[model samples]
Target: MTVRVLIADDSSLQRSGWRMVLESQPDLEIVGEAGDGARVLAIVRREPTDVVLMDVHMPRVNGLVASERILTDAAVRELGAPPRIVLATALELDDHLAEAARAGVFAVIHKDTDPESLFDIVRAAASAVDGRAD
Candidate 1:
């Protein structure tokens, strides 16, 4: 099955770069893109997203908070299964790792992670949501 993905980052360049990498894969599809956590929330609520690759810091709302909201929102939870969220950060992630896990994030990776690794993580997240072993 094609994995529907949403890319959320504040930088236009970052979003574009991720889009290019993800779209090159046959099983992955870029269903939506967002510049901040609030837009991410909106898109997740409206779209049938399987995985969310989100930046840790964003304007309006941050990735962890948006993740928490998505995990706990009754309306969102009722929509079959919630999309798997993978957090990405340019800075040190040590302090946020526990909180991200608490918010139901599937995984966290540094923004500088290589494209192949990024693809692996996203595909793994999608597989987890689908209850399939990767």
Candidate 2:
């Protein structure tokens, strides 16, 4: 099955980079793109997204806040299960990880990490949503 993905980041270049990596996988589909937390929320609300790769730091709302909202929104939950959100950022702070956990983030990855690892994480997130292993 194909996994519909949404890329959320403030930098166009960052979004483009992630798009390139994700597009290389046949089972991953780029459903939409968002530049900020509010946009991420909007896209998730209307799109059939299976996974969301969102930047931890965004201009408008930020990933942590958006993630918490997405994970808890009744409207989104009614769509079945909310999409798995992966927090992507250059920072590797433990505080970020803790915040992500509180907000229900599936995983946290560095922006400069290996493409293969990123692919693996994305696949795992998708698989987890469907109760499978990657």
Candidate 3:
């Protein structure tokens, strides 16, 4: 099955880059894209995607806040399960990382993360969605 992906990032360049990288894989699908966290939940709800590759910092709302909203929202909750949430942050592991962890987001991948590491993240997020560890 294709792993449907929703790309949420403020940078147009980074969104394009992420699309190129994730959609290059045969098993992944670019379901939708959002430029800011404000648009995120609405898009996700509209499509009911499988995974969210989210950038932590964005205008209006941020990934961490948006993620929390998505996971706890009644609609997504009633769907039987929430999507896998993987944080793609440029920031280092600080209190935010722990907050994300506590929020039960699947994985936290740095923006400068190597090509090889992306696969590991994708795999882990997929596994987490499959009812495995986050």
Q: How well does each candidate superpose onto the true structure, as a TM-score? A: 0.94, 0.94, 0.89
Q: lDDT, candidate 3, residue 92? A: 81
Please identify model 1 stretches exceeding 4 Å from their true place: none
- Candidate 3 per-residue C-alpha lDDT over 1-134 given as tens digits, one digit per residue, 9 for 90 to 100: 66778899999999999889887788888889998877888887777677888899999999999898998888776655688888888878574778898777888888878766886677667766748553
Tens-place lDDT digits, model 2, residues 50-107: 8999999999899999999998888777776789999988876575998899888999
Q: Write the per-residue lDDT of candidate 1 for residues 1-134, one digit (tens) a residue.
A: 78999999999999999999999999999989999999988888888888999999999999999999877777666676889999999898897899998999999999999989998899889889859665
At residue 81, give the lDDT of candidate 1. 83
Best candidate (score: lDDT): 1
Sort every candidate by TM-score, greatest first: 1, 2, 3
Residue 24 in model 3: shift from native, Å?
Answer: 1.0
Error of 3 at 72 (Å): 0.6
Evaluate model 3: give its lDDT: 0.82
